[model samples]
Target: MTTPPQPPERYTQLKAVGLLIGGISSFQIGATLAKGLFPLFGPSGMVGLRVCLAALILLTIWRPLPGQLNKKTLMLLLPYGLSIAVMNFCFYIALVRLPLGIVVALEFTGPLTLALTGSRRVLDLCWASFVILGLYLLLRPESAAHGNLHSLDPVGIAAALLSGCGWIVYILTGTRIGRTLPAGLATTLGMSTAGIILLPCLIPTLPLIATHPWQGGAALSVAVLSSAVPYILDMMAMRRLKPRDLGILLSMEPMLGAISGLLFLGENLSSARWVGVLCIVTASAGNVLTSPRNTHH
Candidate 1:
């Protein structure tokens, strides 16, 4: 026999859903804004600025006091921060070289793959098949005889793959760190560490600020939209939701990315890509609906 559920638990579940929706929505908008800034700052400069600004903003808010830590925790967090840095850095690089919708769609493979790997049920295979179908549609060659191959850049494709791996690492590491640290504090420290890692890159770009004020402004906007706001929302969401459920909810990112691109950047996808999106979305929704109800915090 199962024990009766508490009211607090029910409220937490509802809150988790609300936070997940809000966080994903904000992240999508942030990606669109970052895409808008791509031409001006380039990917590296944009990411560097965004991280630095987000670090500053978080520092102001959290004011985390650096204290002595066990070597184990330090080792754990170092890679976690590095993963965050590399994930965003590579994502921006890919963004500059590819369409926003396509880049996001490609990145979705990371979490989807992770989800499918953990399940043994035959139904999970259907989800995997849908993801594979989506990827084929997303990565199909745009050019033919001339060999221009304009649909997706080879380097960009590679970076997106790398970013996806980084995201997987981020998710796994986040789970580990969540056991010991509050989500907000862990996030603050991670972003700060990432910002520090990016300082060298930002130094060279400092001079460009004089030459390209608009670019600098655009980068700042990217920081606020992509890193600062979204991170806070994500912390709130993660606090309320379980890791698996969070993954299921975040799978909406690709769809939101596609919509944002269409509305903000006037980017269009072919019928096949739309079908791909539908398949991935359906698989993700199915996963969430079928999963157990326990929250993930």
Candidate 2:
């Protein structure tokens, strides 16, 4: 009973797919680039620069009105923004101490767990088991020849896990805010609030820009690649792709992070960690394929 897409429509859909992949690549690239600035700016400083610059760019584009900030909206935006701050702050901290791929793989558990929350289905239990096995493999101690898991900083692991918690909050609050406000406006304001919260960290890094102007440019690139481009491309992709299809494509993010880390940062994962990443990736994709159609985007 359903009509197939026309050729032109199919072409557009293909382009959307490409854009989505590109957005994912851009985000990973941005993270790699951000890591390079750690020596000069440190994780907090780099995150502050990236978030504040991204907020400025988004504000310029969306330019949401002051009247939109009603008390009700503010309540939603505050928690959403705080989540962004916490997520990025902890993420960068983890990134400083852990390999980019490993950090991303660990951080992804937040959203994966969120997706599985309240589900009683047997298949969902399988997916949750995959996550647990992956975590066990990733965190368990190993011999030196196999790349000792104990070499990974406990603080870094904790930060990555905490970042996942922040991400859970980000998703919950952002969803509610999206229902009440335009997506662009909500994102802009939330990012702005995060920037304001991160201002203290940005302060110390500002003076360094004069001595290392290139790092400033790199920070801006991080803002554009990580935030603005991905957001814009995702908006376009969502319009053309089914929610499930989009989710499936996005489930490749951890793999993309690993690839980006290897290619750009010269980082390599151990065999056990590689298996851990695969398990998580499989669980993520499986969740997407099996998720109820009526679930919130």
Candidate 3:
């Protein structure tokens, strides 16, 4: 009866919510974990390890055919893989110099901008304004817990901004790639492609890993937490969501980043910083709540 459809609909919504929460939490925690590796392996090296390890993990399961190098797959895969590499690399580099919460908050502008771009709704604009104010507070040096705001390095800021740009590319390409290819197969190949692209940059780190096998294992663990798990969840969630709604859900990332930073990296924030986090959470939540309810699987 009516309960039949209701149960399935309820299940789908629950699954989406679960995936969103799981994906964001796993990604932020893993990001916090990556900070430990900065001293041993540079950001580029870590990015290299993430892709290569994740590629290896996924390949074991999906085992995509090497012979199927169709032109269309090539076109979709390149931008998608490179975008991931750039996004993660820059974010890690920024994390090395900046607090995780601030870096993630600033980097969020890309996906938030994309979500708000064409919306005619006046409230959406209001939410966008909230995000702006949040960014202002976040990036403002005075808001840093450290008494001196100048400690916010420009190189880290620039790298984080570039990471945002990479995220924009990732969302655009990944939305298409996610739908077009089988989930595991697409991720495996795409990660392999990204690893290949990053090979040149990884030479320095290779020696470190060779000297300490633990470094390789550490990177593999990060890959599992950050890339493999969340990626598979993202594909499942995307099947049930529009790219727009999905991007909006990512607004939670900065707040989660802040929490993870505090818990793991001891990156404390002052009252103004707290307000900024509140604003972002509010804006993102409001936007998602007001988004259209109808979704496809």
Candidate achieving the largest lDDT: 2
lDDT of 1 by residue, 1-297 (tens): 977788879889788788777767777777778777667666787788888888888888877655634566677788788988988898888988877877887777776677677787877788878888888887887664456544768899899888989888988997888677777777777888888898876776789888989777767777777777777777787777776677667777788888888888888777787777777777776666665532434
Top candidate on TM-score is 2
Deviation from truth (RMSD, Å), model 3: 2.9
- At residue 107, what lDDT does model 3 achieve? 87
lDDT of 3 by residue, 1-297 (tens): 344577887789678878977988888877877788878897778877877778888888788776765788889999998987888889888999988898888788777677778988998999999998987777677733446545478899899989999989988987788786876787787788888888876777888988989867887789888988898787788777665567567767888888899999999887787788878778877777676642432
> What lDDT score belongs to each candidate, Candidate 1 first?
0.78, 0.91, 0.81
Q: Candidate 1, residue 46: CA error in Å?
A: 0.7
As a whole number from 0 to 100, the lDDT of residue 246 in candidate 1 is 75
Itemize residue pairs with steric clashes in candidate 3: none
TM-score of 2: 0.95
lDDT for position 198 in model 2: 99
Compared with the true structure, the alpha-carbon lDDT of candidate 3 equals 0.81
C-alpha TM-scores of all predictions:
0.86, 0.95, 0.87
Model 3: lDDT of residue 51:
75
Candidate 2 residues lying further than 4 Å off, grouped into runs, are 1-4, 146-150, 294-297
Point out the higher-scoring one by lDDT: 2 or 3: 2
Clash pairs, model 2 backbone: none
